[model samples]
Target: MAMDRLFAPPAERWQAVSPRLCSLRRALLTFWLGLLGLGGAIVAGVVGMWWLGAVIIVVAAAVYAFGWWLIGRNWRSWGYAERGDDLLVTHGVLFRTLVVVPYGRMQFVDVTAGPAERKFGIAKVQLHTATPATDAEIPGLTPDEAESLRDRLAALGEARAAGL
Candidate 1:
């Protein structure tokens, strides 16, 4: 199968989602989760389950460290490029995955931001195609950027589909 390197020639113009994603992901995946885990451990200890509390504390620490690193790695791995006729979305650190969504194949586009994401002032854009398997998503964009991208992609898809 043909695939393009994330920053290779054709896709060299790849646009990153948002550099803030690493911090946002860290807050969501690690910070709050770590707090919860530690709280649970503390509660366990208060209930006379010292062994359980110790185990929980150890597990929480491990998860916090690993998740903190993973969040940054995952954030760095996401990138997208708009080629002439297709949108290239590539991600993953260990098992690299690249998705090329032809403009003509896009049925619709959606921009969304959850409560947590809104709090962080970031949003995501999702591209839908006739084939579910080929749909792609790009996250960690600012609200305005997400809306602009959604509109542009939708227009491009319509124009390209008309030609097909």
Candidate 2:
């Protein structure tokens, strides 16, 4: 199939997100939790006679907000495609990037569903490769799709390893 036919919308062509990645609800929820946790920590610190609570809270809140923004930004731009022998991940809003994971380099593939993902009927496929400290991930896939992709990747890795 042509690359365009294999991918999603043209708008998402640079970072073609999975149809399963519906919204940024997860990141928003995480941000709210982080804010609440930071507030709670500040209260606890003040109660314990620590004068740095306010400063810590301010710094923490700034960092948390930045992190939240980063997640939302990346989430909005993330997309992936499963090529014949490689997985293509395109992400980032500001510093756009594309990651290509060839079958030969993949160590293994995983299909995982967290509580939220399970509720949404989605799973994340994480591909571990020989590259140190760098793994390719494609999140927000339907359970069946995730499984199929996992099996395909595993088979490709094996085939490549066997010099097929």
Candidate 3:
């Protein structure tokens, strides 16, 4: 599609995030929504409001259904690429974002994985620049991939910075 080209990778090779990210998101959504439904139902019962409980449960279920689908789409939307002098990260379905972090401007790179992300076998690579606006991150990468990217970016940043 015409819109796809607008956000395509510079080198025509966009590396997508792991699909396990989708699973992680869906699992979290299910847990939170389930808790909401259960907690609401219990509160409604204690207050003698069966109708309100039903409404809450129905709303939570609806949100969970929508969230489950949206999570997959969102995960699929994420991608990153290392170009000649910059790293490109793109994401979003309705409101697209493209972040270009130049090697020369990179201050440091951070690789992190929270418990849930680790459970899902995924990590995030965050690029810190001298300017906050240009800071970017690529999430849902495998640990090995995240480390490799961090090393490459750090080397590039050092090389470029030393030239200045």
Candidate 4:
């Protein structure tokens, strides 16, 4: 079978994550690169190795540019779809991941937003199941969207569990 056929696309279109997620990722990347540059500068000053510092700076710049491009693709790769009895979450740039979480199997759901995520007005929804390995998460949703999804998933999970 062809690789594309291994994971066929769902009937419904995927709901993409918020674009603000790219901004959040960019901010994080910039912060980390800034720290690396600072550390390199300190080391160079202490060791009197200005050339080493320049090399580090050049490498950091290259990484930052690559990361910036990758971040957008990564953001675009993330998507979720609410099906009849399950939720589908898909993401990844190189290694694709497709998670199918049945409502009945959901033990609990959580909505979380870190300081940086909140700064970008986005949150993540995590679904826990009987086993940790099958758990699925969808990130980069607006606060309101995350709350509604959490509530809806909770209700569906309860209804399905009651049937079993």
Among the numbered candidates, top TM-score falls to 3
Our model 1 lands, by Cα RMSD against the true structure, at: 2.7
- Candidate with the larger TM-score of 1 and 2: 1
lDDT of 3 by residue, 106-141 (tens): 999999999999999999999999999999998899
What is the lDDT for 119 in model 3?
95
lDDT-superior candidate, 1 or 4: 4
**Better structure of 1 and 3 per lDDT:** 3
Give the residue spans of candidate 1 off by over 4 A.
1-11
Deviation from native of the Cα of residue 85 in model 3, angstroms: 1.1
Model 4 misplaced regions, further than 4 Å = none
The models' CA-based lDDT, in order, is 0.86, 0.71, 0.92, 0.91
Rank the models by lDDT, top first.
Answer: 3, 4, 1, 2
Error of 4 at 159 (Å): 1.0
Q: Write the per-residue lDDT of candidate 1 for residues 100-146, one digit (tens) a residue.
A: 99999999998888887888889999999999999999999988889
TM-score rank, highest first? 3, 4, 1, 2
Residue 14, candidate 4: alpha-carbon lDDT: 85
**Candidate 2 residue-wise lDDT, 1-164, digit = tens:** 57434334333334344544544454555667667767767787868945566666666677666776666676777777666667777666677666778888888898888887786678888999888555888887778778888898899899987883
TM-score of each: 0.87, 0.61, 0.95, 0.93
Clash totals for all models, in order? 0, 2, 0, 0
lDDT (10s digit) by residue, model 4, range 1-164? 68754444568778888999999999999999989987997799689998888888889999999999999999999988899999888899799888889999999999999999999999999999998988999899999899999999999999999998
Off by over 4 Å in 3: none
Clashing pairs in 1: none
